[model samples]
Target: MSVDDGAVAIIGWDPSLVRETVARGLRPVLVRDVPAHLRGTSIPLPEETEEIVVEDITDVGDVWAGLTRHFGERLHQELRGIVTFDEFAVSTVAALTSLMNLPGSRLERAVLMRDKHLQKQAVLAAGVPAAASRLVVPGSERIRTPFPGPCVVKPVAGGGTAHTEMVRTEAEYEALLNKLALSATSPFVVEDLVDVAQEWIVDGVMQDGVVVFSSVGRYAAPCLSYTTDAEPLHIYRVDGTGEDERCAEARAFAGKALQALGYTDGVFHLELLLDRSSDTFFFGEVAARVGGCLIQEAVLLKHDFSLAGGAVDVALGRPVQSTSETTDRCVATTSLHLPRGTVVRLPNSGRFAAADDIHEVRVAVLLGVNDHPEVRATTNWQGLALVSAASLAELDARMAAVRGEFIEQSLVAPTFGTGVQQRAFLADYEDAWRRLL
Candidate 1:
């Protein structure tokens, strides 16, 4: 059965993507999970949608059955493309799309895309500039690589910054492994820690075997430089000029990565380093979906670009309206990491929030505020702010003012809890379960 180009099936739910998918002149079928806890907040489904609710969309079995049962007989014929916003579910969505013979990433390639170890292997095979890495499995003798001064430890299939650590010594490396106590099957990936003066992200749109458009973002501080000090949680990781030399280099790197990863259509968020020491660009990491936090919002506020929308357009084989080469405006996003513990009153934001460039203020953990917050991963942040300006200097000045006044009002020391204790607890539970089973 030949599929029509009028309807697109989204295997996951993202409000922005749903809205943009509809705007692109296509019918949307939202395959979403109706979680018991989140039922209180009714997500406004598009007026035109074929929504598929499941117990858990992240599970492959549930997603497969949901798409099959909900789409019914017309799935293969009417569904034009299969799309998803969930990072972990990307492979599952692609595989299901392939089974239905829809237009999307190939099942085999999609599976490899999610595996960080293999992704780097393919990228390196293509002569791409990426962090040198090795896969470590317990009791495996193939661990033959000289360790760098500071390296990053990553679980092979880690979804986000979870289980990721910056190991400064060999003891720390071994300790990280013992700390994880991963299931026998799970292995880990270790990469040379990137020496970065500033971290930048290339959020690009890929379609028709080419990168149509890309945006560059600069971080005020490295995302993974975890510290327990009373540092401001929300540093300005802002978007930069699209035509800058670094951005150009990043775009070239991204093209190579896409080809290597077999990504034909979708939004690709590529994180690479502008090596502070070497004055060179090196690949940090890559994902086949939109980047979390500021990347998406910055694009919209500055260039009216939607990474999620661009992705849908790519899936639908629609033309992309990528941003211009040079950007006259500057945009910055500050993530406020709230203190941990019970609920408390929030600081006064009446002054800084009133600024004109301060367009968006989002509070994720307002119900429960903490004075001494526990930092686990990137998800530990409490709130975020979006600011834009006409120039970099003005942007910095405004950001400094806001930081001094509103962003730093809550003086709480953050606690670093990278699941070390939690891992030990889980290891005990698993031991008990293993014996019982």
Candidate 2:
């Protein structure tokens, strides 16, 4: 398992992750799509990268050809591991891992992590508590409603909440179908919308079928609220204390859910819906990669460890030093959003970065006057902030200050499209903001 001269084929280009891999004494072979790599920020790849396998990382044939051409018959020996931070490449990585006879999660388990319907079925069969879901093929005869009342409809294999919708009535469901314009081959899932009081995210690392590390964080508002209702998305790590029963419950549930899905090794990002009235936790979904947004950053601040580094170690079959520890320290992350509009002004990043409680601020979008920007439906953000506090009360206060003083005051934009009137849109925004508060 020593990685002195071993090379790990990373399926995406992330400079920080590449640096971590290099720091671990393993050479990094970047398998990236040229077009996608160009679309990202202009950060240079780490100089320590051993080789670049340029191809469509999501295509098995292309990746196989590229890797074989580069490594020739030494694919199994030279390449010690294959890994990816990209969600879309999870299944591809798994297939490549097996093809190369490398240590990694099985392809079947990776597929379960990718497809929501299959994931739910597997977990539920293993006695995990999860929302009941039914898969709907576009051309199939309509089946009877599996669950009554409000439900969530989403693509079987989707991310970032794109094309996800909440349907409360038959009319809404029909309208949603027309809106999505799904073809005969498209498949979707319909699941009961649990009355969720709080949504929790559990990020962890696994080694040889056992969870070696885990951390729980509660969202300020449900993820659906951000896209559907225009509420800001925020999450804070739960201070692992005995006072909060949900924190302990979430950690236990995440282990069970990962085991149910047959995810033996690698990292996992799992979501759980808390039904406060019933005191129950339901499996939301699980991904075979790190959670999106600033989750990795937040985890590092809270636990003093690197998930990216850990993923590399596990992939290379090197023993990972567990950094799991309980603490009262608080860390939080929030995504900054702006209403659909033409940007008139950009935010003041300096002010945010100066705040004592704010650890990091990232502005992703650059804008100028009169340029129309597409409305955000996914978790994409104009900016992201990571903040830390001494206590929950302090965290709340600091977050409120960020929302009201920094974020709300910084952006200036006017409604751009002809779809909704500016006045009505303002009213909706206000309502959503109030609900978030």
Candidate 3:
């Protein structure tokens, strides 16, 4: 029986969607100060009708136990259902998996999705088109696979494309293999580069092992180009009916994958690469949650349908409707490309927030902060710029305008010396002398 109102314990918070649900009147039993809780302190549980626990989902052991104990203590009796929002909520997944015996609900499929090698194997077994992939262990000189085979290599699990490399030649492949700091246990997954004509994301909501709502979002910019070149990335709802061939094909294929994976009552994001070679859909990757970044934010602001919100509604058996057609339009987000340089001067602050179409701009890499190693790649910029428009052209124009305004300034590199010596050195440099002396 449904109580007065159901409580949702988000496994993780900070996605902003979780906060939004709380704003919508759903009581979220947050695990106050997850960091402290993980450090072995008993978290104070809020006395509410429902208890929702949100924690950082990572492989760390302490968090696992803390979350596990709370779920067993609070949710074991009064909770209707527990919703996991964080990727590393292994304990939560384990608990749910043990309770419902549902594969998708427990996110075993998420493991397959996280491990590129495993994901490919799962798809291939189900007759879903996929690129050839293999596990590569370091220093196996017998590692003879034709070097430089238009392939990509990356870590077996985790987010972000860090340490991701493309090997087009034998020498580069060898260099990459040698460069990777691998142990006996460390392994990487190498995949044959697919010839993609177009790329799209299949976003959907699953209920009781069935896909209730599905939509296709086409990418206007290439993944490599936008990520590596620091160019703007565009993803918009495709202009077509549900019966459109590509749409139907993608839906059927994605639904099958979901079925095979045993997902139920959750949001799933799957990436598809339309192979130019044979006009087939090649699986790229998937996430058991909403796509990282502003995709969900757009859905909330533009369309009233919140997959995050819908998850809570489903937990309570509330009415959930599909997002409107008006939300189907061109949308794009650009990772603010702050190159490796000292921020000696910052351009006019007004110019940064000037564009009408630009929604948000955040500078993650600040003046005093060290340059992020991952952001060195064109695809891994230090900040993000979000923009939306009615047309792809407009989105592109607005993103370009925002990127054009920022100018990097040079500064004398900070060197380690005694405080007095450092001060003396600074006095010698004209810029530092004027600013500090």
Candidate 4:
């Protein structure tokens, strides 16, 4: 089924990965415009990929122009597919595929997937286990809609867990709104909390209508751990042997949920909340793309296949298959939490890199000579460590080994004037400029 001659246009090409996740028979063409920092810096690119730089490639017309300009000489050979890593560009890629008669997703299904409320309603209507939610605008007359204790609020069209809040009290609800800083007309989703005990992520690749690859991984602690400062984020792939019960149950349940949500092809990342008492395994949301963080690496280590590459293969009508049925290995992705001012000393990761079990180590915060970076929500993690082992205990030990190497350092403030002077100045200047405008 592979398109042999035509090339596929990869919208929003990720610069971090030097090569395409999937090996393609068709030529790889990169159409990218973001990650503005790497403008002058060199990031790897595949040797054969046709690079076309354009502004706002997410715009449908811009995508068309970029693709046509690159492939116009070979009109007889049309594009095989259009794919995007940028979550917001999902609809635009689908639309362009349909317009150009390429093998890809339906525009309507992609749009429904992006819309939070509509997707929830669709799944609920299909009798899929889902949480109750309502759409609320920033300054709507119904802004005071009664959400009982343990409710949640989020953007109708947001990703990366930005501004997501759990409202268990009136005070918390008000504080969440203030933190969000929503405009008078912006849209949001307020939902009945599912009394979540634990949360997990299921990532897989689908070809045609069948799930070609699937795996389940659970967070070390509930994501709500971030509700307080003590908790950091940790996601661990579930270790499954032959006839693993939890993996089997999760796969069957997730497959059904994907069908109910009208997911037909490509890769999917589903976030599910487990509340065993009420027997509720309701999925909070689903994305028609690969999972973020160390998931791609985990998938590669445990299953020996690139989840991102498989999605591209499916998009181009190529065969996408899993090499193994069950895996005993587990991979852990831990996001570290630290004091928020200027970072004094980062963990020396050479020891971790030398360890066989440890897969990767990352320090997210950039250090400056005299200033600290602005601290956002839980999204602004201090660092990360990916370790692998056969059991939870061993995995935990390996992760601890990495953390143990770090020296305990604090973000310090100056004695007089604003402690972090440079950051404070930038923040104040931005505020004043906004007001001036």
**Worst lDDT window (10 residues) for model 2?**
369-378
Q: Each model's TM-score, in the order given?
A: 0.80, 0.86, 0.75, 0.83
The lDDT values for all models are: 0.69, 0.78, 0.60, 0.70
Model 1: ten consecutive residues of lowest lDDT: 409-418
Best by lDDT: 2
Which digits, one per residue and each the tens of the lDDT, describe model 3 over residues 318-420? 5556655545455555655544434444444445557666666655454553354633343355556667777667777777766665434224234433577
The candidate with the higher TM-score, 1 or 3, is 1
- List the candidate 4 regions with Cα displacement exceeding 4 Å: 1-5, 15-18, 34-43, 73-78, 142-144, 178-185, 241-243, 344-351, 369-378, 406-437
Query: Residue 432 of model 2: what lDDT?
Result: 70
Give RMSD (Å) of candidate 4 vs. truth. 7.3
Clashes of 3: 15
Ranking of all candidate structures by their TM-score, best first? 2, 4, 1, 3
Over 1-437, each residue of candidate 4 has an lDDT whose tens digit, in order, gives: 34356677777756422255325556677777655424533345656567777667768988777776777867436566778767888888889878877766778888766777877898888887888878776555656555566787878877766666667887887666655555433578888878777787888888777898887888776665554446567787774634267667777778877788777877888888888687557867888777666777777777777777777777777788667544577677877655444454466666668878888876665553333223234455667778888777888877775665643533433323464776685576578679999
What TM-score should be assigned to candidate 3?
0.75
Cα distance off (Å), candidate 4, residue 246? 2.3
Off by over 4 Å in 2: 1-4, 40-44, 50-55, 139-148, 182-185, 241-244, 324-327, 344-355, 368-378, 403-437
User: Which is the better candidate, 1 or 4, if ranked by TM-score?
Assistant: 4
